[model samples]
Target: MSATYGVPNLEHCIIIAVIHNDGTMHSIGVINLEEFDNAAAVEIFAGRSLDSEEFAIRVVAVADADHAAQGVFALDAITGAAERAGISLLNVIMTPKIAAGQHWTDLRTQEYGILPDPAMTAPAIAAIVDGFGPLPDAEEITRLFTEITPADTDHARTTQRDNPRFGRDTLHEVRKTIVEYLRTYDPDWADGGVIGADFAADERTRLLDNTAEGLAARIGVLVEVSGSARDALLGLAVIDIPTAARIYTHIANQLEGIHRAHMLAVAAVLYHVDGRPFHARDALYRCGLAVLGESGHLSETMPVIGRALLAAARANVETDTARRFLALGPIAARRFGIETPDYDLYPAE
Candidate 1:
């Protein structure tokens, strides 16, 4: 369904939201109610059914005193069809201009300063819906909104970089917190569910710092990746061994910004200590993919990573001189359990 609606007139904007008892607001869509008659109302809600027990429709008008009456009339006209459809029409709410503007501004971007424009109505509606509940403090509401908004790759990158690494005391606190959260963790989490690049990198750093002896201890293992995390790492294998090694070393040393970068670091350390470079790289790669999935960047990052996986396989399979031998290419891809990218340049032979 279309997420936005409006008219060009200068009077006011009517925001119609069908709010569920569980606090989820299903929007009947917004409109300039002055132009919203019975016909247009039916057009907006036509065939749109709602659970009356769970959902109620509310019309809110963002208008000053000069236009408040008109706004209410607009809501009354538009909601006639909604009332007929058995959708309980709640009170028509009028928001002062200042409050409306504040809510609008908050929804324009995500917490990491990423802009999700042209479809910002949902965030705005969320803010209004949140106000109806037992309102949280400003700080919590800000955090809540940030958590709810879907993040892009840029947001993921920015979050990875901007969040400061906690010191030793803070690390212990974080570990304790994570442990508490995991106690109730669902064992049935989908593969690639637990581990994340950012999360693992931090755990690795803490392990290395505390364990003067070595990373052989269980403390160094960190979280496990469940899905096609291994498949994503094949891209790194395509790079020269030296370059890959350098990348891994740098990530380990500096605790790079993204989760994939952290996995690279883990792979490097594992290669030096464990003599299992492929295994290390695969584990980290999978963990990084989990991070991408968590950050909602998987779909966008998949093609690049997936292509690299397939390319690495094709290169090794065709050319005997290749350094890396990916023995289980097809099986690995299938096990990774995501749609492999269409390789136009290097079609499968």
Candidate 2:
């Protein structure tokens, strides 16, 4: 293993690389303390000495003046370990963006800041290249993208419900109505069963398709890529029709405006109150808007459908709506889950 030096108080270090093997380069990112250990182990497993020409390593430190010395020492220790394992050290230094309690937000901002404006008519492909320039392989870029993407389904749902169109009181009434409707319409079906069948399959699909087209119109959006890239991502693989029907029925009961305006309004609300930083909020909102604007309907009602999900996140209030929300996102509703957004649709540039 090779060695480097940095301060001790640094909270986190990320390793970005493109490793070449069998004539192919794979881009990758490693985070957390275990990553360093794994890198060292890899060097040992390869049986190449750090002093030998066959091994190479790079280290980037991130810390402030308070822990600069310790950070340098830590880097040296990391390099020494690699050297002992027979890995050669490459470049190692502190990244400029390092700060206390700054890992999550800073990474998110750095990633989002490079996204191309969706409104741009020319290819936003440049943005993708710029954002991922540090990465050496496609796989690494994909991983980085996933890492930065918002996974807080709970927060997304809360913002949707808080919309004026579907405030807490409204959601309650909607839930009550759905329960009663299910009971009255399907004598043999319980609330869950009715949602799984009648509501999830038919109504939800119609809503999502309509919302997607509507959103596309509102925000002149286009995705650019080779035919192979386009083909790789295009499909209906993510949608669960039955789940969507059931979930939307629950949403209909919870909010008014079964129309495009209502959908966009709900998206805007979700964009604002989800406790995400401003840039993330903007990305999510843009995603929602693009969905509605492109499909001209709720082709993937996950954005709006996700609104009812909040009830499940709250510990004390597990209402029927909440149950339905949780059920919709989980694997059990495999047949009913709504379509997720395509990775390409994300603002990667």
Candidate 3:
């Protein structure tokens, strides 16, 4: 029988443990289910072969079955993967407090035993089984945490279905705000031609003409508007910024490449204003890459972009965000290139 560990939400990975009839258990693989669905599990399973072994499988969850619905892998997909992997899927079990030596029996008829001694508890157990190193020192561990943590504010709790004004509407409102701000404050930036109107109409038309490959262009137009508005919104403290951030995050999640980056930048700025520096840093890292892509300076291996990304990382006050962003520097360098010497003061380590 084989066993799998599934986290329903933002964890983004499933731990697959292969168990032999002889009772030997080994956590064989960690699967990253990007979209968090049953189909994703099936895809992961289809990629592997179990040598035609008769395998019964069980899935263990850290929370109850209800928690699984939030964003966890679908139960059907787990069973499907087991079948494809040449194993029988027995059941799915949940453990509310993974390390408490307890589990939710109601989730499945079959009960599975905990891992024997020397294995860490549930939350840490998976990582230990995956062969990770010892835990970091308290100081280092503390340093890894972000300074401005999520506070579960009213805006943070806003749901998509609740208000239903997240996507294009939010962007339109932000554009209007930007136009009013520019007209009232910075007339020079608008060139006196059109101040708050849809400046991206031409770009949008060009992009729509080639819909197959215009996602980045679509994102670029939004990004340009958002970028222009960012400086203006910096001093304004209002709920609109949070709303825009939420919308940008939603947009970024739907896109790739430059569009994703630009949307993330808009989100980052909003997050920064909302005092969520950690989220801002993540958005900025992607934004840096997207900015390069937008500038038409991306290359197969551009160290210049890497240096600029590194600079953004170094300038960030949040240490953990900086570390994470810097980690992507080599990756960006290898995929894109652009020289923005203005950021040179903050060299990436």
- C-alpha RMSD for every candidate: 18.9, 20.6, 18.1
Name the lDDT value of residue 317 in candidate 3. 43
lDDT of 1 by residue, 176-282 (tens): 33333333333433345465455555644454344222211111122112223333232222223333333333323322224343344334332322233343334
Ranking by lDDT: 3, 1, 2
| Candidate number achieving the greatest lDDT relative to the actual structure | 3
Q: Pairs clashing in candidate 3?
A: 8-72, 55-88, 299-337
**Winner on TM-score (1 vs 3):** 3
Relative to the true structure, how large is the alpha-carbon lDDT of every model?
A: 0.40, 0.34, 0.43
Candidate 2, TM-score vs. the true structure? 0.28
lDDT of 3 by residue, 1-349 (tens): 1122222231334445565645555345445444457666777567665543534455544444445553244555676667666775555654443433443442446555643222344534665444332243335323322222212223412432354433244334444443343343333445664544465444333332332232223433433334323222222213244543543454455554554554565455455445555456556666566557656565532233233444555764443432343333233322222111121224555
Worst 10 residues of 3 by lDDT: 336-345
User: Which runs of model 1 end up more than 4 angstroms from their true locations?
Assistant: 1-11, 98-349
Q: What lDDT score goes with residue 276 in model 2?
A: 18
The better candidate by TM-score, 2 or 3, is 3
In candidate 2, what residue range of length 10 has the lowest lDDT sum? 220-229
Ranking by TM-score: 3, 1, 2
